[model samples]
Target: MDFERTNPIERDAYKNFDDSSELQSDIRFDQVETRLLRQQQDDEYLQCLREDQEREQRKTQKLLDIEKLLANLCLDEEEHQKKKEEFVKMKEPMLLAIEEELSKLCLEKHERDRQKEQLDKMRKEKAPRIPVEPPAGLPELAHLAIRLPNGERIMRRFRHTDKLKDVFDFIFCYPNAPDWFDISVPLPRRDLHCEGSTVSLLEAGLVGKHALIPKRLRLTTDTTALTLRTTPSEEGLDNRRDAC
Candidate 1:
């Protein structure tokens, strides 16, 4: 008991040293916890920044792809237009040649049509006149005495309603008839055959008694005069007179 009382100072010193060591240990532990929290925050921020950068890179790559596609489309369109122009140029001469040939064919066809028309007109002019029959049951008759180019005379009888073409046919069948001839009345100087074959004998005022003089056309220098003969019954002694 006396020894313990005498060492009180030493015991108090040891107690103070232990309290100081415990306080130091608590401060160190707090510092370590703070440092660990700050490090975790920094790591999270860095991860977010890396993610943002990756998104921006992907967006930039997409824009580049779109631009490349547009450029390729423009190039293809230009090439197509150039090919179309070349094709038109290649066909130009052939199209013009076809049009020219068509025009030439049209002109040739027109010329052929004109030549055919001329030929038809010439044929109509050279063709003989067609005869038409007279109306039946007519009592009146026309007596015609025709004088030939050689001063010979022939006589024939026809109905008043008969066409002048009938008289022309009768003369055309004669043995001594000229190849081409014209018949005329002397007093009035009216051409009968050249007027029209459709004219009736009554319309020409040749109903009763009439006389005609024939003039022959000479086709060559050696042409002969037309001569005609008639039977005694058909021959008339009537004097020549203009019926019209």
Candidate 2:
């Protein structure tokens, strides 16, 4: 039997081929590990970017909300101011009218006060005056007879120093005396009814000069005769004169 002989070169060549195959397999394993690590890093980066974008969107939305609230407050303030102005305009005329009415009332009150003052003055002027009393210790007295327009005679005593105004006040106090009349002396034809007359009875020749003897005198209205007569025992008969 003949056996085939193995060559050394061929055997070595086979060994080299086996070593190259193992090296190639180790390189492929390294490449796969590197690729896997790189993909994991890329995924982590994408996740971080998404989180930042969401945070920025939330911040922007908060700013927009604050701006909207500020705008609403501004609108409310403007509307309140407008309403206040409208209310003032509506009440202005009413306020003016009230002022005018108060002014008119004040004027009316003043006018009423003036009218009341005038009426009081007129009443005071029309009122009767009081008679002044005669002084004491006179030496003479006049027995005067006053005759009214209705033919009524009244007797009274008067002092020599009494003014004619006293006689006029006495007549005014009478119940049935006329409101307006004139007194006059008949023999001399002298009027004695002057307003505010200050002539005394002695000065008008109506008082007796002697004591304890009264002079007789007649005081008459417009329709009666006024006369002065004294007793014969009285002195100074020619000195008795009419002073009216």
Candidate 3:
């Protein structure tokens, strides 16, 4: 009924207004849908950021643990080196002392061996000759006290007819006697220099008429050689001679 009374222009205007209102409603609905879609995309991006942050935290913690383990290993290595150094220092002096003791023992053993060899040689040379009766008619056995280089006094009885060389032979035949030597009379203070083969004890003045009193004879080793003899005063002290 209202459409019949209205003019064509007015109806046309009302229809256009209704169409405009429907179009506005449609635009508003589309705007709301777009806004909701944008909100969902933003939420997903925030979740992704949170996941990345958590992964980064875990990686950082693992790196820190590795660093701590490395630091502990370095400390242990340093301690081991210090202990090795200490062991070396403690062992050096002990090794040196042991070496020194071994050397001393070897030297002592060598000295003992040398002394034993010398003693053995002396025993094999027919040592300690016994006294025996002499041939008759030679001035009833003259007794004499012979002093050796080692301060040992040897007592022997000899015949006046025996050569002076006999006394020298008996004394020099003893063990540990020198290669060359000289004999001197102590009481008369005279050196005996008689020829060994020709001179007799009576000619050399070594024996007396008495039998009980023993004459003292000094035996000295020739220091350098038999050819070289210094003054009689310096013979016993300065030269490499041994005197009794």
Backbone clash numbers for all candidates listed: 0, 0, 0
- Judging by TM-score against the true structure, name the best candidate: 1
The residue-level lDDT of candidate 3 at 81 comes to 75
lDDT of 2 by residue, 84-160 (tens): 56656756875897799899989867765664454344334433543444444545776555555443556667787
Global lDDT scores for all candidate models? 0.56, 0.51, 0.53
Q: Which candidate is the best by lDDT?
A: 1
Candidate that beats the other on TM-score, 1 or 3, i.e. the better one: 1
For model 3, where is the 10-residue window of minimal lDDT?
A: 230-239
Model 2 gets an lDDT of 0.51
Which pairs clash in model 1? Answer: none
TM-score of 1: 0.33
- Candidate 2 residue 2 Cα shift, in angstroms, is 99
For all predicted structures, in order, the TM-scores are 0.33, 0.30, 0.32
Task: List model 1 lDDT by residue over 1-244, tens digit each.
Answer: 3546658887778778889998996566445434443554466568668979998998799678656644544347688677556656756875897799899989867765664454344334433443333444457888676665444567777887777766765665454554345676643446665336667888877776566655454332321221111111122112211111
Q: Give the per-residue Cα lDDT of candidate 3 at 17.
A: 92
Alpha carbon lDDT at 144, candidate 1: 72
